[model samples]
Target: MNLGLKTAVAAFALTTMALTAASAETRVTYKSAKTGSSYYQMGVELAEAMKAGTDGDISVTVEESQGSVQNVMEVRARGGDYVFTTPPALVGLAQGGKAMFEGKGDPAFDEIRALFPIPSLTMHFVMSADSGVTDISGLAGKTILLGKGSFGATEGEKYLDLFGLTDQVEIADAELSNAVAALKNGQIDGFVTAGSYPAPNVIEAAASTPVTVLSMSDAQVAETKRTKLTIPAGTYAGQDSDIATTSLPVVAFTTTKMDDDTAYALTKTFWDNKAKLGDTSPWWNGVDPAMLSNIEGKIHPGAVRYYEEAGIALSDAQK
Candidate 1:
């Protein structure tokens, strides 16, 4: 071959190899919560963790989600390398076509499989005004923003009716991202958000304006039948006492469309780098192998491989 021709051919070969390597890189779509929420923040952190953990071999694209219901519903359309976070109870509902998913059942819902637990979805009823009532009843007569189509919104509605505040409190319908600003501007009295404790949006609102995290009493906790959680005093700005609340177990899951190798890598990287992630974000510290029992349906085969090798026990249902 002539010199120029040989050089051109070599360059073409290198370009082809580069494209091939790029194509081999696995790209994932991670759906969690809307922007400004702590769950969304965790999705961002998980994306970063995946990039670092897999040495750039596996990349995650974090997408803004309205709520866990949206995340679960998207499983119908999402196929390859798709992952999302939702409470286990929602997974069961989706499979059974119950609650918000009533009559919306699709065979795709059956493909959803559990990956790993990220953090519990702790309920937060944040208020900037002093309603004089210590528990959630104080929310009565206050305008509270419960963003649409999220676990928080659904739970908030139920809590209002359950605690007898439905008509008493004004509902400010808005996007969750605007909540902190709304509270600070006196546009809304408070908002309900569900994410890990020490939620970023709550902290932001409290720091900007004195805020109260409404607590629930023991009987009220029993009435809700959700897991009880206590945010210790000093957990939030200007909050002098501990706040009692309920939390829903949230787990990351993917469909059968994902390859086992990618699932295994993601799960392994999560537990391996969890401590480092927690150092930067307190929410990650809430995750541990013990929470694996919370996963509903069958655990992903790839995640099962990691848990087995790590000697972590899995509930019979999870196995």
Candidate 2:
């Protein structure tokens, strides 16, 4: 071949190889709850659905994390491409830098962008029936396990503060599975867990021993209006009555580093295959396209464009 023709052909081959590699797969990481937790399971399911919906163009790796607070920090540090977190934690970190972000020397966390809202998490304060604790008031002067460095732990402290029991009760830090084990062995009076109804850890503990899922007092519920939630009747084993408590909205978010095309594609793939995703877990049943724009942190511009194009109005908060 002529020298000029050979050079042009070699450049074209290299460009073809690079384009092939880029189109072959896009690897992304997802930070979720600790292993064996509901949030983690949901992340796995989402990763699967996304891969299938995109025809394997996107591959998501699910990494175990300490739930919302840790996930937020990880996302800020670019530890993962996507994260499962709560709205309150995102708002606190982004707007006021409160809670876990307080005095952490990090500037206000405004770079994270919301993708979509998942299920709402209901806080459960489960006590051993044998502990002689029946309600929130009985937690005083007793040790309670709150998942350390987790969103649950922060909320647990807030509940104690609102009820004037912070000084009276002894606070212990542990993960959910360990906390349940502690409750079973009488090492702790009660432990706080927040997630969708019929949390696996709570169910596993209730099956082995008698457990009391405590309810918040009317006055206490009124004090924290933002987290008001209820555990409906027949939601858990051995629990026949509804328990009024606190709750928070769980959302999926990504950082500003995510490209707009990828973000838009991921968002579209999720909603397009949402029904199939919901079939895998009840947690997805609560996901509403209309609620996508209702999230606290700024919505991803790609997601915003997708929703707007689909005729879904952006809430004032999202705007």
Candidate 3:
């Protein structure tokens, strides 16, 4: 080969190597809830924080999803690298392939790993005053609205089973917006949703109708306590008193496919900038350092390392 041709070839190889190295920085896609939901907003905030904290070493992109179940499926499909999910949905997917994942494509859910918990989603059983359904027990023979393909429906069914009202009540599945409209038009006696306090749909429904947030029976509350779930007082409009209800921890997780160093960096970035991220949503205000230890699923080795360095202990399930 001519000397000029050899020089050109070497230069081309060097350029290609540099470009590959530049593009090799970790890039993660985070699947969040629907556009207007709190989870979506939180995901955006977390992504931004990660980008800034990592100093461009990692880039996170946010993707909108239906909710917990969809988020899990997306991550499993390699559509995203991380997702926001609740314990019930994750456990459902992991345990028996039940709930929204029942009979769907097979995914190794056990391979999913937990990163951290954000906040708790309180279950709200809201009924119109005119429906005369003041508490959970009053829903017998009534049509109740549960969001279509939502974790809310799964939790609602569990509530029905606990109260033994499954057969006695008619379950109507609809989207949140549609469910709110149905509740306003008296098409449904009650609506069951689980999310952060002051959910916009619940607020809109309460604005249109005289609604009451039902409290769980003592027995029901006792049963839920085993899972460390609780609903605090005055979570929504017209909910003047404390309501006893179950809650599920909202956790961020990733699959085992994610590299240990990247997961460690992402986890550290989130917690290290918790104060800054808290300003993005009211949910973050409730984030406690201790909650990091209270997550489900196997903790990613990377996250486990970061937590250990930060002096946070992992729960048996997380370990």
Candidate 4:
């Protein structure tokens, strides 16, 4: 071949190589609203798993807590590639039921879809047993610190309403740590938190001062579940033991607009390596593949693809 022809062919090959390299690089960012919490730790694990599962083709950046509201906003703005949120948050977004979301107008929830529903989270209406606080209904007229910007806050209110104690209780908004501290300092009667068992924060307080986890009778559980106030097993760390408690369902979600291939790949990568992801924090030990995508709103096409490929049937809505 002529030397000039050989040089032109080599340059063409180099350009093609560069294009492939760019296409092979995928950058996806995952943000969780619960910063410094077990949820964030789980996200980090999921992010790492996704990176490794994709054979380094897909890269993930995890930023904990931009707040659930903000996370939803980011997803809508096309700023965030993915996020984790609770069922109430998911339902509120899907149904435009943001009667309590602070700040700007509600985003379009119909645009969001469930990636999975983590195990149910027991709603701990915490107080010192020494304070004579046993049931949520007993905390009437007392200050209750509920975690802010979380579905826990909504659950706490629902708990109050479910038990006909709404008018009896005074809601105090505070961060998890601060609320726990407030209870310790006698500023508030108790703090309400919802999570899978041995809820780290609630356990932290329980370890310090003896606290009681309330389990209203089956009748109450039914009412709370129906009304959105709840506690669920696996929420406490010692589920293998005799501790029995019901919990509220907490669903995690992502946007519906994501392409099917991306969602499918993301879901598969995360679940396949889920065991390793939980190693970072025991909080994720409860995440089950069976629990994935079990709540309201239709599953995103990507999620549907993953489930179907795995031999799970897709719902009619998903189809």
By lDDT, the better pick of 1 and 3 is 1
Candidate 1 residues 121-209, lDDT tens each? Answer: 89998887654445686777888899997778999999999989899999997898899998888898889998787788898888888
lDDT values for all models: 0.87, 0.77, 0.76, 0.66
TM-score for all models, in order of appearance: 0.79, 0.73, 0.71, 0.72
In model 2, the runs with Cα more than 4 Å from the true position are: 1-18, 33-38, 63-88, 95-109, 129-134, 138-150, 166-189, 286-294, 309-313
Error of 3 at 189 (Å): 4.1
Candidate 4: 10-residue stretch with minimal lDDT: 235-244
RMSD of each: 3.7, 4.7, 5.1, 4.8
Q: Whole-model lDDT for model 3 versus the true structure?
A: 0.76
Q: Which consecutive 10 residues in model 2 have the weakest lDDT in total?
A: 79-88
- Index of the highest-lDDT prediction: 1
- Write down the RMSD of candidate 2 (Cα, Å): 4.7
Query: In candidate 2, what are the lDDT values of residues 1-319, reduced to their tens digit?
Result: 9999999999999999989988778778888678877878888998999899999999999988865667666654673355456564565564576656776635425667788777777788999888889888898889888887556677888988988899999877567669877887889988888777667778888887888899887788888765566676766677889888877777888866788777788888888988997787755765677555347557888887788888888776774
lDDT tens string, model 4, 205-260? Answer: 77666566665666776776542333345444332223334555566567765666
Cα-based lDDT at residue 305, candidate 1: 91
On a 0 to 1 TM-score scale, where does candidate 1 land against the true structure? Answer: 0.79
User: Which residue pairs show backbone clashes in model 3?
Assistant: none
Badly placed stretches (over 4 Å) of model 3 are 1-25, 32-38, 64-111, 130-133, 141-143, 166-176, 182-189, 222-228, 289-294
Using TM-score as the yardstick, the better of models 2 and 3 is 2
